[model samples]
Target: MTLKELLSPVKALKTLSFATESLILTWKEIASLFGLNQDIYTNPLHKPLAKPVTAILIGAGHRGNIYADYAFIRPDEVKMVGIADPNAVRNGRFARKHDLPAENRFYNWEDVFKREKFADAVIIATPDNLHFEPCIKALEMGYDVLLEKPAAPTEEQCRIILETAKRTGRIVSVCHVLRYSPYFRQLKQILEAKTIGEIISVQHLEPIEYVHMTHSYVRGNWRNSKTTSPIILAKSCHDTDILRWLINEPAQHVQCFGGLSWFKAANAPEGSTERCIDGCAVEGECPFSALQIYYRDKKRLYVFDLPDDTRKWNKIILRNLKKTNYGKCVYRMDNDQPDHLTVNMQFDKNITASFSMEAFTSYEGRCTRIMGTKGDIVGNMETYTVTDFKTGRETSWSLKTDYHGGGDHRLMQDWVQAVGHQNAQILSSTIDVSVESHLMAFAAEKSRLNKTIEPVILGV
Candidate 1:
């Protein structure tokens, strides 16, 4: 039978309410029938703080701006007191948005530190290689921190930050925003309740969309492992964390396999030049054509803002295209990180999990399948389905939100609350827990390099 024909009975069964028909309710629907729907993870309706927890923003780039934007929405919860970035334009934009005065804006993080502590906390959104110093210094200066993830580029650096947080008695929350998302929160709740019996295995994939991969790993700031970090650590540490969280156990061993299979000089189209803006024969056919992505369609323009003068904007863009790596042919760039990877892991209690990251997908998001003794759950960021193994019944749910399933905003709110209350436990992605996943990513990279199974050694 065709797939649709086979699923017709299942559809009919789902439509019949338990009270009206002799139907086998799915484990998920049965849970709902038992009023599980009423129990959801709710954020605290925090009363306005008597004095808002003030913060300094370091590395006022895309990620930093995202965290700082929360102040625009809820100014009473947290305030942006100081801004620091090497880029004058970016720093000025953030300062103007928050109405930061001249004294509160600095060109470098060191200058921000030169002054005595001006804020209750710091949001360290510097690049991977730049995380260690500012985080350690901020901790020493009596500032709690919300450090952007991969915590640091190296395992040792991650440890130093964790140790500093401990010694200084400061709360250092990593931006594992997925943990704060409602979808993952509900999934954790279901697992905790044993609604799916015991988890046996998990299959997760992070599909880095083609254009996105080209924009980020291929041509953008994260193009080099030596300068930044591995693609796995840079992009998928959150995936490792989610797997560990769902399994509720420490990962014992891991094996990984991948390489720079595409997006290299060997894979470039015949007759294509090093840069796409040069009259390339395949510009129209090529999806990774920098001209198409950056100039023609204007899709990924987060790196620089388009100027109001069309003529000036075009001139600036063309100049950048000639001088910068962003305009290079994807297959001719100097990127070293793999465009595809797979990791197999064994957690404590013999639970197993597998994860994959690929750059050839049509859309961006994560897809996951969790199998338990009695039921299985399958989901993406937007929706999920639960099936009871015995009855073949299914229940599904859909969620709608913008940007990481509302995780970015949720994480900021939680950090504000945690910092305001001086309570570290209120934060979801604490440094201690987040560091484990970073270690796993490191181990995974080791496994990929040596072609051997590696043990995950958590430092803190």
Candidate 2:
């Protein structure tokens, strides 16, 4: 058996006995003598912080809450000292959870900055359109920033954020959480080790599960590209960043094709009403019925702010459904994001990648295939397999998945450590590198709209 097979759990267990265990341990020692060990390739999340990193949270919404949660589990590594969110309910909820003092809580982001810089870093998880201002202000005030993805809604804004971070000499680690995922980290190691030889091409897919598409892109905050941001930047920029990272080259050319297909008024069922709760005849049969999705199935209700009373949840949800966009019929909403899109990209070293974002899939996860000179790798985000061409040997690993493949918490850990030591090297998605991915995404959207291949121009 090969070294990996010998070390694999199932095979190692089979050889476990008083004598065999000792023999296998000796073999493992001998194998380590050749400079091969599983421990060497770890992307460790736990690290000693030089000092605790205190941060101010801007926007206590979903993404904001997710990143701040890291503080609760590891208070020594990071602490939330201040919070600014427009919504009182969300702000109060976050403040109570983090135990923020009354003086530290504010009703607006602008108020957080009116005072002198109070924290080592700022976590800006505001809405897409609101990111640029707070990020710029926070960096100017000498606080390192953990800005949410897309950076901003425009190419110029993304570039400006990068430039501001550079000019101010404050660290800006964009929230490209996928880079911290164990599965992708292993893939990066395989390529860096030349286990798959030189890279050639890659195929990546982001299957935005159907329910998620309707909830977010069709009926929710990101329904209009003009208001929030294009779905490419809002959703699939993560994929673009992953492709750019895997290829390890500056993107040269991009061509894209897709459009808003099935979620418009033209495609609504014959008897459907503008709202699901309006006694629409087809509400019972329609899968996109808000009543079914929110009231009955209770899937995707995390976006809603319900009451504290568990017994009153149904009443509050139904009431909000009537008042908010959440109850709107999917087919009649003012959404412009494409249901399906494909992008072809060329990088500096003859490396190429094709990425597809599909909103029709029943399941969600990134599926990827990377081709190289020696062999290829294939994986869904949870598991991956590498095959060797010469020996016909295959090695596989199955990872225990969590939020964003356990990237959310892992990124927070690394960011806190990086901020504590004032070292950018600890992060994988620093602003300079992340801006390139956003530029590529902008180029893809231009290509799709103009029906011409677009050259990716870096910087402001």
Q: Each candidate's lDDT (Cα)?
A: 0.84, 0.84
lDDT of 1 by residue, 354-443 (tens): 999999999987999999998998989677777677766565656642223567988998888888988877787678889999999999
Quick one: RMSD of model 1?
5.3
- Tens-digit lDDT string for candidate 2 (326-427): 999999898999999999999998899999999999999999999989988898977776666775545555664222355798788778877887778778
lDDT of 1 at 87: 94
Worst 10 residues of 2 by lDDT: 18-27
Worst 10 residues of 1 by lDDT: 18-27
Instruction: Score residue 269 of candidate 2 by CA lDDT.
Output: 89
Quote the positional error of residue 95 for candidate 1 in Å: 1.2
TM-score of model 1 vs. true structure: 0.91
Best by the TM-score measure: 1
The regions of model 1 sitting more than 4 angstroms off are: 1-31, 37-39, 44-48, 308-316, 400-405
